[model samples]
Target: MKIDAGNVNAVPSKRLFLSIIADYDLNRSICELIDNGLDVWTRAGRRQPIVIDVHLDPDEQSICVEDDAGGLPREDLGVIVGPGQSGSVATAHETIGIFGVGTKRAVVALAKQIVITTRYQHAETFQIGFDESWLNDEDWVLKVHQVDDLPVGTTRVELYQLRLLLDDDNIKMLRHHLSATYANFLTNPAVMIRLNTVPLEPRFFDNWAYPPEGSPQRWSGPMRTPSGKLLRVDVIAGLSKESSPATGDYGVYFYCNNRLVAPAMKSFEVGFTRGQAGLPHPKVSLTKVIVSLNGDADEMPWNSSKSDVSTKHHVFTALHDWLVTVVKHYATLSRTWEGQWPEKVFVYDDGDITFNEVDDFLTAKRAVLPNLPVVRPRLPVRITKANSGVAQAKPYVVGLYEGVVAARTLVKQDLSQRNWLAFNLLDVSLTGALKEYLVNDAGAELSSLDLAQLINRDRTVSADLRARVPLPDPLWTKVEQMGRLRHDLTFGRAAPKISDEQLAAADAIVSEVLARLFDVKLAA
Candidate 1:
């Protein structure tokens, strides 16, 4: 007997088909068919235009995806149905399709029966049917035949006996997914995609800009995969013009090989709130970062379905620190932009700064930010109750009464503490109200500390605040006296005691400043 090396019944059962189809949904299955046409364009040297049209007939419960991107020849009919057989790999084509199961999985996921028609060069239309019986049978064989005439360089796939219902809501969502997934291709002149008779337009990310003081918003660098493949990464980060928080349009978008793998990610996956202070508040939602990775498709960090990033990939791990730094930088800055947005942000680039749409902003000529080491700024020593024997909220003019109560409670042990506490409260209230008058009414950037220093000495910002805030000379004398007292108390030195009459005078100054700036009376 001739000893033949035993073949171990490697043919997969019909259940494998069920498993494959179950892994995909209606949107993902449709995308797989579109991706097939795109791979054909890449294999054909990408010299000619590729037009794909998707038609949905809800009455018939069928879908048709037709593409003019180099139809399949007769020889490919046999191999395409087989699992683990990829034409791109066999022919050494640079394409996103690495596995051969995409088409088979997509077609079976949509319907129980599929008909594929193709016309290549001079050959007549080659037609093949994968019917319901083929799925139920154990035979791994398929039949192909020549059919009626079709346009050359065309492939059409029609699915019938749909497994799921075709509805208007799902069709609308599919349109949005296709527009965003193939956004880069839609921008090219040689490619056009239409769904249900409507041509899809690219979704552009709108950003905010300020012309004067340049804030860092763009960066580009190179990273090498573990297999030594080079991945060129370009990052554009800024505040969005549309300020809807926790929406799908906000957060970091990750694109691989011009295909959006991940969209609007704001979680630990993109290094948000990982050992840093970040939350999904409206200000943090204003932050938008687009990370585009262009290189070999196999080396990208995307998962199998191209729906999300693989956090464990070496290329993504190499980029974690950079992503974290930029995200935290912009998230912190956006939190401080609530009231100052009008004074600091603009809609368009004004020749001095290049803040435009995300796509154009990346392609336009600009400076490439160097990969500088992130030098964490030294944090100022916090004055806690343990060190300064006092704890108070930072004065910003909105809430001054809380500081007064805290100051009074801190000195309640002394016999003459009531008079001292009254003076301190009057001083803090006057300082905060005067600064508010300068910043809000007078249109200046003044702080409580700046107001105190301005009364004592001459500094550029403080002097400007004084010039902008119009106060009478008598009020200026009271402000000067309060500023001196604040300086002495802050340094823990002894200051002359104040009587009830002086405290009353300081109270009048506080009330006057508040009424002028805010048009509100002091609390009785």
Candidate 2:
């Protein structure tokens, strides 16, 4: 082999396409483009509110993300396709683009043909296109052309000939993903993002608080990394608004440089132990942990996709123990609150439950979390040890009334259930009593006309009988009443409806019938 030059050919192979984009799905890919626009806006000092519009046209099999953030300078536009090249000039703590491959990877992952149109501030519009041909070859050369009649001072990325055509479900998911990913940015009154003409609404935590005593905890401090970068960390743990226990909506969330890197993470990696021993309990569904890390983008403990945390990273490793401790503490408190705490309101006795936002706590001055007021062991505790004298007994009386109402409700419910049960007992008892009197005692067959006649007679007719038979008038009357009541309840007949008094009478009748007739005593 003749070595004309010692330089190695380092052009990226076509296989690089799969490697760069393999991990991204439709939602995350779109997020990468959004991140680029926001990063550019930050780099340009955010002179005006950045308006990013995402339009997903399934019928056209295309997506267009246009942003009013300052467009790329023509000289620097090559960075869009050049691996490791970047146009961002943001400081370590201000940017979201770190590896500089997010835009290119997102473009290729989405479509075969990509057209990026841009116009630098007060400059002629320029456009560049990347197609299947360019993707198939190893050539790094690209041509940018001046274009007219285009939007000025803006950048537009259009992806057509989609690699995976979007459907309704994909569009819905993309909307949600973008809403969550840029929640911090969208919270700014200046920023506006639209998806399919509808404005994007950010999803942030709605934490619960009973102020002065029970509020979310906050701890924020700056730490110097081993590499000497200043990293700021803020951790807030508290109760969130009610959500389904089965959902991932109530757990640890991570944000790096105001971008949501992970949402509602409740696995072993984030201090939720495996199995039922830990956070899986329904009582802890209100638990919310928000961790904000703002610092050098490269130093943050996040993966390239920004979809997960890099647990092995030293920064995260240092944070893991503390994170676990904090989560466990709040999770225990959550369980306790659900199990013991009364209605979470500032007023102790009576008011609708109110909650303060988690952001309020996150922004508060750093301090040790105040211990929650001792949750009364029982709800509506009107007669605590501190309570004294006759006037204070008014609280006890009010509590007694409330208790009476609740007890009455429960008793009525039990009575209703017992009525159905008593009906069942009536049928069985009548049959058993008849068998005992006719067959076992009087030694007569059940089919005998005399026995049937004896049992079927109404209370009036049976009242005249003086034969000293086991078929008594009282039993007959009780059976008839129970049967009619059962019929009325089952068929929605008129009332003499089921009540506590009626249930008690029925129970007494059943007990007498069982003991006097069927020989089975009702257990006390």
Candidate 3:
């Protein structure tokens, strides 16, 4: 007999087994479960008044919630408290509490002990108490008792061993959260919720009353989402004075399945529409943009943590495109209303090579010009054999007069390519030859050399060369003064000083010359 007893095994009862494995965080979990449960209850067409009461006592470190909802039946209590129960599945509707593990598991997560009191309309009130230690103890059991003095239509849940303290700010935020969550219930008047001693208020933006005097212009369009869903857009613009620049004040709200979710940002595609308007007014804050997207039970994009929507889905893409188009359109409208055009215009032509050719020629000349001692005196002097008979000699002495003249010639040549007339006038000022030639050859002896053609053919000639090349205006005055000196010097007359008035006149003349020569307007 003793040997046979060793082969026997003990099997724990089902109730005792699940009780030991119930999860922790029971208090917080129970609150969320109740919230979701109320959502389901309202949607199911339950006519009874639903009330949620939350009580927190920091002194006792306890939190409790009581609801006047359809209490759980005695038979269903096991499934509600037990693990892996799905009571809502039999109802065939999308219940907020889809998984049966919600309330009990959440309660187990929050506190070490919990007590649930429930009463059905026709059934006797029942109380069930469980401790955290009983979850794993094989011999432990849940204490269930029936009572006659329980409230007529209330289900109460009390949690002990709180992990988070509820302060004033937290309470206020909770109230706001509940009001937004249950906005649809406000119109029904059958649902009432209270936290501490204050009653909760539900806020719905759609019902916001407009000012009585203004005729607000309403703008609406269908925004197509990438997922092929047509999201309707509703905008209220012209809320301000029509004659005022700020009259374009508008509010854009997004709704999904009739519930306001979040404010839309301009960075998002939906926000692009607002940018298009180019409204001078500042953009509305995120809190001001009310967005509500209808969420279905099948849409897993909306997880329990409803902070963000799933971007990978088609709905997100569609929403993005719609917003961007709206912003673009608004920007265009703003520009049109302001009667303004873009300040700058850019033109590209493939066939224009004249400018390029000029640039290329200048680059080539510059590369070779630096090496030519004729242009730059600082270049190393080079000795060359003259006919192999004379000793190696430098061709010409580096005289300041000759060097200045050479530099002036190089500038003249360059400017002549673009504007020959300006170069010629500058040359007349630099060289005494212009006056000498004009005076020597009377009106009858004009040569066949067309001065304009000659200047145009020489691309290297420039205004600086003309100004410094011994021109004739006031040249006699300089020459006579030089001749009166003790030693007779054959250096050409000194170039005239360019005064401010002369410079201004030269600049204006050059501009006009270039405009006519190139047949193009010069930009100031």
lDDT of each: 0.69, 0.69, 0.43
Lowest-sum lDDT 10-residue window in model 3: 340-349
Error of 1 at 235 (Å): 2.1
Q: Write the per-residue lDDT of candidate 3 for residues 1-524, one digit (tens) a residue.
A: 34554554555443443353333332335445555447446454566777778776667877788887767677766754665565564234433444455565566655667888888655799888777567656553467789764565567888887656656676666666556555655556777777776777776443222222111223344434433333444443222112122432233444333333332333334443333433334332111223344333333233232323445545555444433333443333333222111111011111211111112111121111111112212211221111111111211212212232233334333242323333334333323223222333222243445433222212233353244333343533333232232122113275333443433443443333323322212221
> Which residue pairs overlap in candidate 2's backbone?
none
**Candidate 1 global TM-score:** 0.67
Error of 2 at 153 (Å): 2.0
Q: What's the C-alpha lDDT at position 220 in model 2?
A: 65
Supply the global lDDT for candidate 2: 0.69
RMSD per model, one decimal:
14.3, 10.6, 23.6
**Candidate 1 error regions (>4 Å):** 1-7, 90-94, 206-208, 211-216, 346-524
Q: Which pairs of residues clash in candidate 1, taking residues 3 or more apart in a chain or in different chains?
A: none
